[model samples]
Target chain A: MSPLFTSAHEGTLAVSAGIGLLLLAASGWVSVLHRRKPGPGTRELVLRLRAWWVICALFLGAVLAGGRVGVLLFAFISYLAFKEYVSLIPFRRVDRRALFWAYLAIPVQYAFIWTGWYGMFTIFIPVYMFLIVPMRMVSLQETKGFLATVGMIHWGLMITVFCLGHAAWLFVQPLSGFPVAGAGGVVLFLVGLTEANDIAQFLWGKSLGRRKLLPGVSPGKTWAGLCGGVLTTAVLAGLLAPLLTPLPVRVAVPIGAGIGLFGFMGDVTLSALKRDLGVKDCGGILPGHGGILDRIDSLMFTAPLFLHFLRFYYA
Target chain B: MKALGQILRSLLFLAVAKPFVALVLGVDLRGRERLPKKGPALLVANHNSHLDTLVLMTLFSVRQLPGLRPVAAGDYFLRNRLLRWFSLRLVGVIPITRNHAVSGGHPLTPCLEALDRGEMLILFPEGSRGEPEARAPFKRGVAHLAKSRQEVRVVPVCLGGTGLALPRGEALFVPRVCRLVIGEAFTWTGDTTGFMSELEDRFAALEAEIAPPPFPSHPNMT
Candidate 1:
């Protein structure tokens, strides 16, 4: 590893270049729209692009800084996402202490990632928090809405902390035998592909989508879009894997396709969540993106799946 | 030396308060442009946590912080010498007497004086922090304070989720998103009742400004 980048490697630079190309393309596309009759759509597109710039800068900077910084960033994100999820649900006064413990699990989960305790990182939230949160709630001995509340808290912890923690855990993995691109590359590969899959689906859906994927859940998603998106993402993943990962072309393409499929699942799942809650956005912190959860919901599912997949086959 | 202390106090306050508010809790501001640019202004909000004052302070520029005085209960904020010093010196709080004014002085007398000095005062009409994320009926404190000071622009702020972040009883902060919706400034129209009702209506509207839109609770709607 170079002293300048510290934890960054070939894969890190590869991911950065990919993001730069994306920005260049977006900026160029937006600039050409001025010659045509511009409207509210144009303004929104510009705002969306600007937000992407900020998101990219912050993310890549964290990755480049080293694994520790990346861990902290993901920890903060899990904290924010959990905050968004729990705030939306019905929580009583009795749940305060339990809420504290649930929140404490975020740091503890990330601490495992920081210390490279893969065993605990994977099961702590799913197994331990699953039992412990309900126990704390039971200690309060509040039975009314007890089961519902306990189930909801544990589920949220799994999604926001456990699932997202996989991405941070990627940063901590030993990259000595993996590839020259290092751990940063693996983290970037997952993020870049997941994000690209989202964009590809949106574009494909808009252009060729004649049928709704889930008419009740997401009115926008279409079958045509999903197929097109997964295909594109699979191809992109195959091309980038050689530069970024230790995976063979056969493994990489399937993982890419899996990511695309799972990414869509996460998006619609959040859509269903918002629908059930009867709210549009989780939070309005991001101008165009909604909340941190909204921006990274796809990653919430994809991160855990990819991390475990790599563990089974390669790690 | 006084000016030096003011600068030092603001530096310390900003150093400690800004990050606590910004980093730990997410703040969503609405109608922020309506916040008064200059003082002799009144910032009335619904209180739930100690963070109510801190969250409001960060909305203003650093230079204006010296003159921003949060109107807090004298008995609550000034019971001890240490608290008294911290509140008075660091927070720049103008302690409002909560007890009966047996001395025949108006309860809002000190607040009136602060406004006279062109300071921006934050008043929680609820008088005290109560339950988390629950809006208590705003007392007539704001109307009472603004009654004599007709020139001061009364900016109504609806602060939500501060309680969820650091509620009254809890010492530890569980990070949660906080919302502050600043409403259009209004004035006392010589009728305390009318002003109170108007402020009440304004808060209702501001709370709705930050509140999530109503949707069917059951999943059947989709």
Candidate 2:
């Protein structure tokens, strides 16, 4: 094996390319179907497939570029997520100074990942930020809405910067027992399955979904979709485990289930956020997909959980 | 020379000010369509920070910005040579004396002249920066000008978050999301006092619309 590409890494890349080709074929089929039938959902399906092509190209390109580029890519994702999150939420003029400090944490957190400093990367945002943000707000001497303002800023940092930083750490941090060369493959596996879980749930829900899973928060999710997604993702995870990570097939089953279930929770969490804020989408950065936050809400939960799971068993 | 200056001013506004506000403050403009596309109109807004004029200037279409003149304080903006040149040439600011009683000329004369020439004029009714929560009572000059030039539509605008960006006595600007709420244009139809009160009410309603909910009292902080 080359220094950059292990057999597992190569296999994951091949699977990614295969999926991309299948998506292209699916898009072509949908375009022809739309031309013949001209249905309402056909246009949206074609648009989604087109977006998937772009997303796949970017993801594979970053993964193939090696660890430094992969980590940088996730850092950029964290920045966009933070920008969208901050812009959507209501914050006062008094909170601006504190918000500046919150924005500064992005580069510093990514720096920790680049240097491979695990301890500082974990605590820099969650702990030190928790203390410094409130203290900085105190200097303004405006007590009105101080607590609420501070809490919102801190929450934004934790979810967008801190949790996403964990995904970046996965690229650079070394596990004792696992092959270091397969880090890119592990990232590909996690992102691939997590996104696949989202698509599968949506498809199953549309076809077989009758009973509402949580109608008030996320009306589209259904019990049939949940079960179908879990089964499909678990099977895929078990299949891809050997080619992506060192985890055994039996262990991969539960890990895949964890990713699917938690990914559902993250989706609903953001749904509740949008519902409370009275916004349909966070922002309009992506076409077809609502915003960066809308697309990556599931990863926020899955990344941190998967990172810890791998560390506990494999590391 | 005048044409060259106008071109430079337009370039400065387009290339520098617009992007600066968009990137730094994340300004969200609402009811922009309410602005008249082609007409002489009086725009009155609450003053909270130095950013108010720049923000208002950015909101106008490039074609309209040339005809738009903002009424500025004679004391602050015209105090020195460089400040006076920048105010007049760059933003097309018309100086109004703070103490019209002591000053020789009528404070509303330049504003009226601008409107007479079919130009759009922006006026800060409060006349100077005030605390965000409470606006200083509007001086009678805006109402007087509106009544005299009844043909010019008087539009009330309510601005929020500029004070937080560059509050009084603070040199550095803190980036905050600002909102500019452009209100409906109404014709003047009453005494100066009545018009002043109505305008003040319009500002109050807008402030209420955008104000953040009050913070709950904490045990630690009185």
Candidate 3:
């Protein structure tokens, strides 16, 4: 249990090289795959690819720099995505009072994780945020769906703050003996794998996703695409385990499967929220991407569940 | 103390109306401090729907900021006895004659007097409600008031998405999300006549200049 890695075992440099190769491979594969799909216009395609490029850059940066900086980057992404969600929902003057609590939750929840207070991070949203939000609403005495309005705020916080905050908790995990399970590596694996699954699912879904997973909420999502995405992530998890976690190939597969399934569920849940709110995206902040909520919907569900599993097994 | 009470009353109305309004039309507002706390402040807003005034009032009221007395039309607010009474007292409506002198009551005088009393006035300088496709040309009233009261700062507001909920010549109040954008206050300058004319031109040109970007985090200058 050394405090740092030996010179030969350092995965930072190789991780960068691997990422470059992965990007080149992905672009090549996507080009050949979609060559005849009647894709978006050249300008639109460039813009869409640029967003994926930024996400990849963030991924590569996280793997290179572990610990607090890694966790902070993930937290920052969550906060921006959540802001995008709230902006889209049209809140009434009475509902405006809840915003103070909603905005306040972003920093406090992350602070709990930053201090290595995992217990507080877990319940901050469900318990503290839940109580404080309703109380804030009560002060406004806004009789509207006092319950429902408070519930949506809670739910939004849960998804945006609590669930997304899980990625930050990776900093607190003890990664002394792990191979692919170092704090930095795990964050990279979880984020990269989950986002990769998203990209894979979309590609697979677009190409051969004939059967709808849930036609009412999201017509594009399909069972075949889901299976394809999970399978891809599982294989990637096995290959990247030594660099990311000490769990080895055997454990990484199951974990990757969990991320893929839950990430898909997160996407569905967010879709449901949009359905109820009658909005397409949370806000038009992201081009090629609908909104912040759209981008992090998968992370919201995957991050928290991943943290819990890691904590139960390793921490 | 009076302003405080006015804000409390406005909040109370919003608190009561939240359920009915939120159930049907969603409402969201930010950057409320843009409304002046003490002194004469002009709330110039884009007139898209008939509900713009109500939504703006609800917002200013809930902030517990000073109550806004909107400058409405002589023809609309002063049409019938019941409406005139309700508009004047309940909503604090000050009727302005259509490009002409007031028939009986004071037109700009009430607004000017309100300013002197350190009250806030919501001025819709379009003269009347506009069609959805285009915002009607702004009148010179906002410029005149700003120039006459050099000490006052005029706030520009671009309201989006209220017309779909409530259209012109419609009696019912429909439900929809409305945005009240509060830009920073700017003082009226230059020669009085020219300043007023330039102000009107600038005010009308704002919608095109702003486009559809996210609301500014710190939009208010003063």
lDDT of 3 by residue, A126-171 (tens): 9988899888888887675676677667777877778777887775
Report the lDDT tens digits of candidate 3 across residue range B1-222: 656645555665676555444433545444567766655788888787767777777654344334467888878778899888667655777776775543555458778988887777887777767685247767677777887898888888777657645666655443334555566678887576776566555555555443333332211101
Q: Write the per-residue lDDT of candidate 1 for residues B1-222, one digit (tens) a residue.
A: 778879888787678777776767778777878989989999989998998988999888788888899988888899999999889888888887878755367788898899999989999889889887778888887887778889789988999878867888778777677878888888887898888888888888888777754545522112
Q: Rate the local accuracy (lDDT) of all candidates.
A: 0.83, 0.81, 0.69
All-Cα superposition RMSD per candidate:
3.0, 6.1, 14.1
DockQ values of all predictions:
0.40, 0.14, 0.03
Q: What TM-scores do the predictions have?
A: 0.93, 0.71, 0.60
When only the first chain is scored, the TM-scores of the models are 0.93, 0.93, 0.87
Model 1: residues >4 Å from true position, as ranges?
A1-7, A24-40, A179-181, B212-222
**Candidate 3 chain A weakest lDDT stretch, 10 residues:** A1-10
Which pairs clash inside model 1?
A: A11-A181
lDDT of 1 by residue, A1-315 (tens): 122235567667766977889798988899688447588888778777888888888898877675577788889888889988877765656677888999999888888888888789778888899999989988888777777778788989989998898898887776547642377778888999999999999999999999887999999999999999999999999999887788889999999999999999999999999988877888776777887889998999899889887887866
The deviation in Å at residue A113 for candidate 2 is 3.9
TM-score of 1: 0.93
**Stretch of 10 with least lDDT, candidate 2 chain B:** B213-222
Per-residue alpha-carbon lDDT of candidate 2 for residues A1-315, written as tens digits (9 for 90 to 100)? 123333446766777778778887898899999898887688777776777777778778776665677777888788778867776666655577888788888889998888888889889988999999999999889788788878888988999989877777877867677766677778887888899899898998899999998999999999999999888889999999988788889988898999999888888999988887777877555656877889999889889988998888866
The positional error of residue A203 in candidate 2, measured at the CA in angstroms, is: 5.5
Q: Give the CAPRI class of candidate 3.
A: incorrect
**Candidate 2 true-interface contact recovery:** 0.17
